[model samples]
Target: MEDLAIARACAEFADDKKAENIRILDLRGLSPVIDYFVLCSATSAPQLRAVRDNIEDEMKEKHGQRPLYKDGNYESQWLIIDYGNVMVHVLTPEKREYYALEELWGDAPEVALKSDEPAPEPKPRAKKVAAKKPAAKKAATKRATKKKAD
Candidate 1:
């Protein structure tokens, strides 16, 4: 499977485990690095391992896929499952926050994992009116004063 497809599949599997902060970053343009980065966090060390295992199991069951390499299992603070074109990071909350993989790879476009729950509609951003020139401000002030007097 392609990296993007693997990312989506792994994300779905992670979601089943209630993994938090599921994100897929497209790293193709960033460097000769992997094609995609799938980052997520679990509550505890055991949960981290569960997610790591889930990725392996789900990938194999769904797509006959397995990681080319896997590491960081001894400590369980972080677990990385490298699936050729894509890499999955399962981390504890502390490790996730401390490392900030999203920020570290800020340049890459993120692909959000879909869930059964509908996503909240994005709140409208406040539009930035161009800053008023000094003269414009003075005129507005004069107008306001005139209106008050009237």
Candidate 2:
């Protein structure tokens, strides 16, 4: 699979495990070492393990891709799955906040996920009108009536 596809697949697998704040960074031109980075946050150790394992298993089974190197553990609150061209990071909320990979790789553009359905259109905002004082109201009403008569 391509680097972006692999990164997206890893993100999908992580989402399958209810991973939070999932993001895919496009480092194609920015980084010479890696093409993409898939980052996600898990609430607890069990969830961390689930997100990591699911990504690994699904990638291997569906895409026939396996990580070239893997590091960290659930207890450490962070895990790295290195796929040579793509790197997947599964981290706990605290560790993710501490590391701040997004800020560190600030130059890398984020990849938008593909959605099956179209995005909902934004609702129009209501226009605000200033309250008219009693004198202004009378004058405005008289002008409107005068215009109608004319």
Candidate 3:
């Protein structure tokens, strides 16, 4: 599969597994080591494995591509799946927090996380209205009530 396509597929698979804070960094211009870095956080070991398995399965089934190397297991807090140009990092919250790949790759442009459905239309903004204090509101209401009573 193409490098960008591989990275996007990884993100889709990770998102499908409900991985938190999924980020795809475009490292093509900045890093010589890899073209893209797909980072995601799983809540638990089981989730981490599920996300990893999903990525592997989807990539293989759809694109006929598999990770050239897989590192770490379900026990480990972090799992790295190296697919040549694109590397996927499936990490636990702790491991993700400690590593902070987003901060580390501050220079690299992040790929937008997209879902299967079409983007929702932006909602129209309501006109801003000044809010009256409770005391003023109450006083106004009392005056209105007195006028009606009179």
Candidate 4:
């Protein structure tokens, strides 16, 4: 699979494990080494492990691809999976905020993930009912207005 496809697949795997703030950054022309970066956040250690393992397993099974190197355990609150052209970073919310990878690589354009499912239909809007003025009040206001005009 191509680098972008692999990155998107990794993102999908992370999403399956409920990873938050998942992002795929296209670094083709901006970066010298990497073509893409898949960034995601997991809430806890177990979730971090799940995100990492899911991506690894799915990539291997579906695409016959494996990370060339894996770094950092779940305890560290940050994990890196290095494929040749793409790098996946699974981090905790705190670590992700601290590192600020998106801001660091600000020049790299983000790749929008296309969902296979169709867009959800919008909910019908509730009809608004206009409040009516009392007949007595309306007549009083009309008389006051007529007096002012005279």
Candidate 5:
């Protein structure tokens, strides 16, 4: 139960950091060793490092979860974080394409993770006008002059 939660949390955290092609695979019935797999792709080395750091921070802070067996450096194209039953794979686009984890683990059912991020609301645009707005000071000066004449 805790492992599953961690997997979901890791997936969300990766997404929050703009990780692409996020996936959660269920290996509960298929594999005796592992239960879940959270896979995501990063576009660049910096993004890969960011995703890894954010996931580690979130897991440690939120659930008191730590990686039991972590492999691959941030500089590498692929990194794996293992937490007993839940394994997270952070990879570059090239690595992901080469490995094709989704295709390899074709039997593992995909798990859905609900993102905490809300859809961005559209910002209100300024109404367009054919002409520039009248100067407030100019209008005030005109009003003052008219009042003085009266």
Candidate 6:
């Protein structure tokens, strides 16, 4: 199946379980390493396995596809499911934050899932508050005034 199709399939599969923080990053330009990266996190090990199985089933049953490689199943910490064009990473919250895959591949163009149920909007950007003039600035102004007085 095409990379986009596989990505869509994986996203749909993940959505089925209401996976948290579902993301599909297009990594074609970032690196020749992979075409796309589909990532999500599960609350528990069983949930992780379920998400992985759902993805596999969606690909195979809906698109007649299977993963070319899979790892971390025994450990159940992070599952990397590779389908050549698309790579799926099902991780735990701790593992996901620790690995910071999104930051690792920050250059990739992200593809947000458009569904009737809107995804949680990306976290709000931190506002840069203007710093107040320090006491040193006030003291400097006072010194300049005193010099002018003298």
Evaluated with lDDT, which candidate comes out highest?
Answer: 4
lDDT of 5 by residue, 1-150 (tens): 466678889998999899999988877766667878999999988899899889999989988888898899867799999989899999999999998989987977777675353222322433555987679978999999999999
**CA deviation > 4 Å runs, candidate 6:** 74-76, 115-150
List per-prediction Cα lDDT, in the order shown: 0.81, 0.86, 0.84, 0.87, 0.84, 0.81
Off by over 4 Å in 3: 115-150
Instruction: State the local distance difference test value for candidate 4.
Output: 0.87
Window of ten residues with lowest summed lDDT in model 4 = 117-126
lDDT of 1 by residue, 67-87 (tens): 899999737588899898789
lDDT of 6 by residue, 1-150 (tens): 567667767988987987789998877655655877899989888888899888898889878998999888736589999999789998888999999999998866687665333223333334567989899999999999999999
- By lDDT, highest first, what's the ranking? 4, 2, 3, 5, 6, 1
The TM-score of candidate 6 is 0.73
Per-model TM-score on C-alpha atoms: 0.73, 0.75, 0.73, 0.75, 0.73, 0.73
Error of 1 at 135 (Å): 55
What clash pairs does model 1 have? Answer: none
Candidate 1 wrong stretches, greater than 4 Å: 74-76, 115-150
Model 5: which ten-residue window has the lowest total lDDT? 117-126
User: Between 4 and 5, whose lDDT is larger?
Assistant: 4
lDDT of 3 by residue, 1-150 (tens): 567778888999999999999888877656666878999999998899899999999999989998899999888799999999899999998988898888898877777666443322323434557976889889999999999999
Number of clashing residue pairs, candidate 2:
0
- Over 22-97, each residue of candidate 2 has an lDDT whose tens digit, in order, gives 9988776566678789999999999988999999999999999989999997789999999998999999999999
Q: What TM-score does prediction 1 earn?
A: 0.73
